[model samples]
Target: MPDIKDPLFQPYSLGSLQLPNRVVMPPMTRSRASQPGDVPNALMAEYYAQRASAGLIVSEGTWISPLGKGYAWTPGIHTPAQVAGWRQVTEAVHAACGRIYAQLWHVGRLSHTSLLGGQAPVSSSAIQAEGVNVFVAENDGTPGFVQASRPRALDKAEIRAIVDEYRQASRNAVAAGFDGVELHAANGYLANQFIDSNANDRTDEYGGSLENRLRFLDEVARALVEGVGDASRVGIRLAPLTTLNGCADADPETTYLAAAKLLGEIGVGYLHIAEADWDDAPLMPVAFKERLRTAFPGTLIYAGHYTAERAREAVARGWADLIGFGRPFVANPDLPERLRIGAPLNEHDRATLFGGEARGLIDYPALEAAEA
Candidate 1:
């Protein structure tokens, strides 16, 4: 057994999986998938395999369909080539004795016509996310982000079809050999847009009241549950207080608390809360944390700017079962081991954070190599 005194090192049961430690490597979009098809490749597989030391590895946001894609070069699980590519990633991680889950994503209004083949992005409503920009490959062979375009509100039939897309993506993920799946409902993406009243203005059954607003999440969760055939093998991410990608709910506390309750009712294996990682980002309140603990009956994971000390405190206080390290893990593949030995961490290069080659991806030296 791991040292109980070090709450961060102690093992915890996350749904049906028995994690070796409380360290989690949360999803961070590197936007490095192979171009032309946004398919996972050997380079992506190698990157994930190197970081397989985490107790749980949540793969970056992967689009569920072409319509769901918002950024250039981000992987998708909706196609045959993409599924095969992800299979390589999963196999590599598994070979390294790591368990990985694919995060299902749909960006909604956080998209650009340049990236969408000139098609307007789809969302819960026709509202545009003012001042949001999405990264796209420039015609000059350089990467650049352009302003997000106004989105067309998805019709009822289209909404239902998107749920099917999520279901198919879950099936593809399982077939691709992922240990499980995580629905990317956080960070002001598609699901977040539907949940945020400011982003969603509709008089239909899927809009207006809080219950109506939650309808999209409910349907998507249900479809994933049905596809995966086990609630214990599924997770959903939520970010209540974030105003990212032009999404801000009228009453975040109440809206997120209710969302937690609904997700609990749906019986997902775990709930991943994404805290804003920016320095000036507001911290999630203690009261909100307590309420969330009561609202969800499954394992709870917290992400965003968490240090070792804070992660330990959260685990000791029984609030978070696991703590996720994003940028930290980007530069430290063996993060758990480094934390265990209290080694100085390597800094991640911000310039190579987004779309990049191996220079910043799999080239980050491990602690032993750095010492050598």
Candidate 2:
């Protein structure tokens, strides 16, 4: 008897927040927003609201400052209008009896001059990522992504300002009616830049030695916890296994484990990590992620090409407490219901992922919606 009860359907706790089920609506980058960089559209609200059956819903990456907008059209939390806009989003999710967390982001150096409000993108060092940013190319006939520009490194004063932005963003998320705030420390963003030695070549406190490099993220975690007070009201996302855009280090596993242990020590909610880049390549070995379960010593969320069967297995074996679904969630709004009944899922469309009208964003047919 393997707890015969579906591990995926069980209720769990991350400190003070009580989740209704273990299935999580993980953060997916849609890059859709209203003009002026601070407003979320009605479609995004409906899209997230319809999928509220999951235990938790983490929002798309939201910039905490103007420079944070490494890509165009992504939502932000730096203005009054943005807060009010998010208020509507939170109200809708709560009306559906769902809990939501906003992911605070700073896309350091992942932008071009056009995307940064006519300014250059900032980075940990004067290095550029050898990859493309997937945002809606404005002025083009149809929506699509493009390559980013080389970026300049941030000075110490600017670095301090960025930390303040995260602190303020955490406060703004609480005021906007979210249950918690998620620091976006993954996916080659600002915090991840500091974590990756290749991306971070500064001799300042935010670079060099592991402790020095990790200081910025630690400060962010502490500040976010201070903003919300309760550990349950705080969570973080980290993409530890990514070697994308030619970003590499001497030893990523050691670097990530140190970062994970630091977050666990900070005591601000759960640690959500990108378990692997995809099905073909998982960043550390399965054994390494399992070891991180103990290293974190808090609720651990694992995402990256995980199937329902695999998720259940991970939960049963204690490799992860919650499972964050990316692609499956993209094509299935009523994902929990579908999984419970072993229903067939709608395949996600690659064309409509980034910036589209409503084809793939909100048109994912739930079982009941389709039946009706």
Q: Each candidate: how many clashes?
A: 0, 0
Per-residue lDDT of model 1, residues 252-309, tens digit only: 9999889889989999999999998898999999789989999999989999999898
The Cα local distance difference test for each model comes to 0.92, 0.83
Candidate 1: regions farther than 4 A off: none
Give a tens-digit lDDT track for model 2, residues 1-372: 122489988889877778877889988888667875548878888988988888999999899988888766789998998998898899889999998999998888777777666787888888878766645456653555677778888888988888888889999999999999999888788788888888888887888999988988999899899887787678888877776544566777788888889988888678998766555774457788877876887889988877899889889888889999888888999998888779999999987777656888988788977788
Q: Which parts of model 2 are misplaced by more than 4 Å?
A: 1-4, 134-136, 140-142
* Model 1 global lDDT (CA atoms, 0 to 1): 0.92
For candidate 1, the TM-score is: 0.99
**Candidate closest to the true structure, highest lDDT:** 1
Candidate 2: residue pairs that collide: none
Which model scores highest in TM-score? 1
Which 10 residues in a row give candidate 1 its minimum summed lDDT?
Answer: 10-19
The TM-score of candidate 2 is 0.95
